[model samples]
Target: MSEYDKVRVGRLVLKGEKLKTKKRKHKKQGRDEEGTTVRDEDASAHGGWWKTVRIEEITGSIGIEFGNQTYVKALDNGLFTLGAPHSEGEGPAPEEILTAIKVNDTKIALKSGYGKYLRVGPDGVVTGRSDAVGAMEQWEPVFQDGKLALLGCNGCFMSVAQDDDSVVAVSKTAGKDEIMQIRSSTARENENVKELPAEEQGSLAQVEENYVRKFQKFQDKKLRINTQSRSGLQKAREEGNLHEILLDRRSKMKSDRYCK
Candidate 1:
């Protein structure tokens, strides 16, 4: 039900605001043959008219389902992954304005709101460019139960993995278990517990060992106290001294109640 859900492909969106342009004083402009001889007046002025070049769906559901919030933002620098946008009529959010175009039969490409292509590095890092065309920008849509999980590119699934810093990472993997619901684009990592590195795992093991030692010490102390009480009772029984046993029990009770 958010405003971004209404956005579709080929729709022209307004940016911030409009601005007036000054007349060119000099006209001796040199450019390539295919380049423009004169800049378009409409393009020069800021009328906030940004056309929706592409619409890439992060999830398979048309409605706001589990993963419907996932969106890729096309910024001036590059294509950044984003979630559902709240902005309405004013302007299109970067993530709400992307063109998911089919590059070929089995591949697809996500172009930014301003025509930049989303690309991924071999190391699973993602970036966007205005003028680069490579296989790194292409992805194969992975389906689960006839629903779209996400696009798979290179050797990884084009998914978002958030790190400890809360920054969303452009990661590629088969999937992530950090998140239970598929609604979150970034992996919801549990910050309270951090999975230690291989070298640091021994520290966790050492902690466990310390707990075991403390528990064993408590058990040994409890056994020794019980044995001492049994010996006291046996001594009282041998002498058939009921009064002494009762006195001893009362003294022990008082000592236990007052002891630190």
Candidate 2:
């Protein structure tokens, strides 16, 4: 397909990525407020600890099955590969990546990984690979299968580690107010493709009509050639030069032309 055909699909993915990045940054800052940040004391950077901040993040691996024995390779950029790698890990290439992510006829497979400190859902979506919580440490909240685990703040008359997962729902946590509650991958989009705009639709229809005319003209020429061959065969039969086997062969040749 031409680059123009990809205009709509490409735009949607690009927009989604932008939103994902913004959400990630905001979450990082929120986690930071609850956790402590450590900066290296040494001026020269050769042997010093890297700046550390706590964050809650979620991650998953996707395995797409294209056809028999075909799968995609994961990349740091979150894209996948199509064909077998020329040399392991070198990459199956950009063209292959494009083919793997094609909008139609491709099936996706998802594998969820280890949970993170922050939970996106009540106990549902686990955030992975985040360091936003700092070094306070954490214990997994035992979320009863169907119970709502609200991350409320404060205690009986109380005091506790302010960085716990439960703080997410508390009204007073420094950054809890800004956490955007969003449903991941839950958008309901129209599965049926939208009809092209009238002007665009008309242009495509015109292109189709031209293709059909060209195909029809080719068929007409083939038919005319067969008609002349049949006439020649008939004349050959009537003149005393007729041979029964030759007549049968001519008929077979006409039949075989289409097959060829």
Model 1: lDDT to the true structure: 0.42
Each candidate's TM vs. the true structure? 0.36, 0.15
What lDDT score goes with residue 14 in model 2?
52
Best by lDDT: 1
- TM-score of predicted structure 1: 0.36
Tens-digit lDDT string for candidate 1 (68-110): 2233444456645444533322223444454556676666665
* lDDT tens per residue, model 2, 89-192: 23223322211111112111122222222223242222223334432212221123322122321211101123432212223322323222111111123223
**lDDT per model, in order?**
0.42, 0.27
The reply for model 2, stretches above 4 Å from the true place, is: 1-117, 120-202, 218-260
Q: Alpha-carbon error at 255 in model 1, in Å?
A: 99
User: Model 2: number of clashes?
Assistant: 11
